[model samples]
Target: MPRISHPRSSSTPLHEGGELALIERIRRRAGGGASTALRLGIGDDCAILRPRAGEDLLVTTDFSLEGRHFRRDWHSPQSIGHRTLARGLSDLAAMGARPMAAFLSLALPPAVARDAGWLEGFLDGLLDLAKQHGVPLAGGDTSESPSEQVLADIILLGSAPRGRALRRSGARVGDLIYCTGTLGGATAEFAQVQDGRGGKTQTASSMNPHLFPQPRLAAGQALLRRKLATACIDTSDGISTDLAHLCEASGVNAEIDAASLPLHPLAQQLTQEAAMAAALHGGEDYELLFTARAATKMPRKLGGVPLTCIGRVVAKKRRAPQVTLIAADGSRSALAAQGWEHLR
Candidate 1:
């Protein structure tokens, strides 16, 4: 079990400020106006959202639980807060949507709530990301947890042109597969952090993929504007598992080139077998995995992130595996959905 500690000290307990005060603190820090899509926010029973005319609204929700999603000992409050919002934002990104507003419901344990430092860090991380994407923290609920764990749930709302949002089921046989950014950095960084080899500083510029994975929102939007992707999904559950989801949704198969896999520099530091496993199954990379028509002339990068053609979609063969990995020496093997599956 990880011990929880607050970096900064405060004489006032969270209860002294009360729940309403907490909400007010968040509302004051949430600073808005960048997104005109959110007409009214943060003090109302319901937030008013005005999606651009002819655009469709997209909503995604994710839960971040202590022990399951993060550890108080291992992850900083800021990282915890960032990952909470990032999870929901990445979903919006995968669908090629522009985030408009966010709702956060938090359950804090006494240990976390008692100290103002933790909440400050958490809000700092979450609001910083929200500002970067121009998404307003419109509304939410806060409560004391019955148990000793912190729980956070974020609901993100986004918008996209009507009939233009990407879908995983749009992939067709022969569409080339591509992914934004490199792979396995999250898993590699997690291992290093767990083993006490990771960095102590937590800055946005730091190369801590596990702690602060960047959601590929811009890349997803670029694909939408250019109409380049036939299908898309964010790599939140790792490529192996998420690709299986895409294949199942599209009723197609995929063949990935093992040698062509874009391994993250951190992943390369591991042994060959470990690196390969991490590349295949490391979850929470938050990169976008997409398919485009084979004839499309894809640029070298999208939204400032490099694009790599890792594979191509294929017609599903009867009784054959849905995904296959072709090794450097002409060997082929079935690729299983081995990444982050809950309740297994």
Candidate 2:
């Protein structure tokens, strides 16, 4: 079952400084970037981003809603902020795009806005990741929330070589399905946090996979540069769900060797059945799930992330399951889209 945490109480509110003052503070923290792509950033009505010669611009947007995306008590402000931006970055990564700039629109309720500590922590988390990715905070809107919750929307702009960005519909029959890194770490950590077995630390360490998922941007870019993948999609949703997406988009079906799944160390802590379930249905891993030709010789790892061949694309058969998982015992079963679904 999912859990929601209590809201923190604060004596101060963000309204005290007005919107302009808050924007100034964020601008100072975000600082001016050296990226030649961003000719103008915050303080302007709109940001100007210069795409590289012969590059195609890509844009992605996402929403982070309190109680839906996160809980204030369970997730640190830093984690919340980091996740808000990560959601968009992961989308860019899915299509083999390099992040150029980011725009954030934040709406804070009275309770949340009153806490300066929380706000600063959120900015620190967001700005840190932005800096690491060379993505400057460009321009966005800010307003007060009508409800007692925090709402964040981020837009990420990226660029890729013209006519070369990866797509879900490009996969062909006989292509091998590959995924970057281990599976189910985020879902495993979320269970721990919900059970009160995980600490609410501000540090977004690698171990806190649920709180801080690292987007596989480098691997996506490498795939484009090397022509290593015919299709690509990020596993923001679990493999079972995401694989179905790839299959549907490519008008194909797939078969997965269940034993070949690279379960996360965190997920391995669970019972065997639970671990398998988590790996198949877990969401928000932010790893890339891609397809390459069977004849393609792939490196053991791309961008320092392990690549695992877990499945293969097949021709779509009438009345056949979109995805089939083959168990160690030689049993096969349908793999449903059991991961996260909005308004479910």
Model 1 spans with C-alpha error above 4 angstroms: 1-14, 342-344
Q: How does candidate 2 score on lDDT?
A: 0.86
Model 2 ranges with Cα > 4 A deviation: 1-14, 342-344
lDDT of each: 0.86, 0.86
Model 1: per-residue Cα lDDT at residue 264: 90
Error of 1 at 47 (Å): 1.2
Error of 2 at 336 (Å): 1.0
TM-score of each: 0.94, 0.94
Give the C-alpha miss distance for residue 113 in model 2, angstroms: 1.9
